[model samples]
Target: MVDGKGKKMSKSAGNVMAPKKIIDQQGAEILRLWVASENYREDIRVSNEILKRLTESYRKIRNTFRYLLGNLNDFDPVKPIGYR
Candidate 1:
């Protein structure tokens, strides 16, 4: 529904990003950061060039998480912390 005018992000458009795609390529963290980086009120565009640049930062985050997980391999948590 482009009347030569830009539209906003919506669930009805069916242009929503798929979870499986995100998990397959970079992982959940990348998708989360990408979503967090944008302003929801404005239109969000997805092009290969943009995704390419974003995925770099995404991969870095994923790598950092991986490293942290590896470093904490031996540690085990007895229970999860609850926020007050």
Candidate 2:
């Protein structure tokens, strides 16, 4: 594990990040998403910068879903709408 500054996370170094802390602050879903999104083929870096970017991406995804749902609210299921 690596800290936000790219330093190796270690108990001796007092830089280890507690899982509970991350889950508490960002939720379990965000933590899971971060792990799943990574390649995991090599050393993984966990930093505030990475988390910030991931949070921003998650927000964008939520906004996109909201926009799509809002636009579809006016559509009628009984009548198929023609797409351009």
Candidate 3:
């Protein structure tokens, strides 16, 4: 894995980022999204900026879903409304 600045992660280098800490601060969903978005064939880079971006993306998707669902508050499945 690589650091956000693209440097190799190392113990002695003091650049290791703990997963538990990230999970506690950002939630596991964000981490999962980050992994799924990366190309795995190369070194994975981690940084505050990347996590922040992912969080924003997650929020956008979640908010969009919430908005779409919110509009269906009065929806009736059995009595579907016909389009005008």
Candidate 4:
């Protein structure tokens, strides 16, 4: 979690982020983004509010990819398009 004040996230600082809560609320990608976006030198704060928002977006994306892959598995590209 970030104080949004340039402080570092650490257990000693009482700003440690929870993984289960983050995944449960933010899905995963957003949490991933937060990890990628933030500098390791500084601490990040991850409140439930942010987690919930990002999770919904992540869920939509996850479902879309699943649907596409599942549907594409039944395709038959070998049938000559013009002949069949």
User: Which one is best on lDDT?
Assistant: 3
After aligning candidate 1 to the native by TM-score, how far in Å is the CA of 56 from where it should be?
A: 0.8
Ranking by TM-score: 3, 2, 4, 1
In candidate 4, clashing pairs total 9
lDDT of 2 at 69: 99
TM-score, per-candidate, Cα-based: 0.46, 0.79, 0.86, 0.51
User: Model 3: residues >4 Å from true position, as ranges?
Assistant: 77-84
Question: Measured by C-alpha RMSD in angstroms, how accurate is candidate 1?
Answer: 9.3
* 1 or 4, greater by TM-score: 4
**Which has the greatest TM-score?**
3
- How far residue 70's Cα lies from its native spot in candidate 3, in Å, is 1.4
Alpha-carbon lDDT of model 3: 0.93
Identify the superior model by lDDT, candidate 1 or candidate 4.
4
Tens-digit lDDT track for model 1 on 1-84? 121134443568755456677567767666667667766675666534555678898778779999999998876588675679
Every candidate's CA RMSD: 9.3, 2.2, 1.6, 4.5
Model 2: how far residue 49 lies from native, Å:
1.4
Candidate 1, overall lDDT? 0.64
Candidate 1 clashing pairs? none
lDDT of 3 at 61: 99
- Where is model 4 poorest over a 10-residue stretch in terms of lDDT? 42-51
- Backbone collision count in every prediction? 0, 0, 0, 9
Per-model lDDT:
0.64, 0.81, 0.93, 0.68
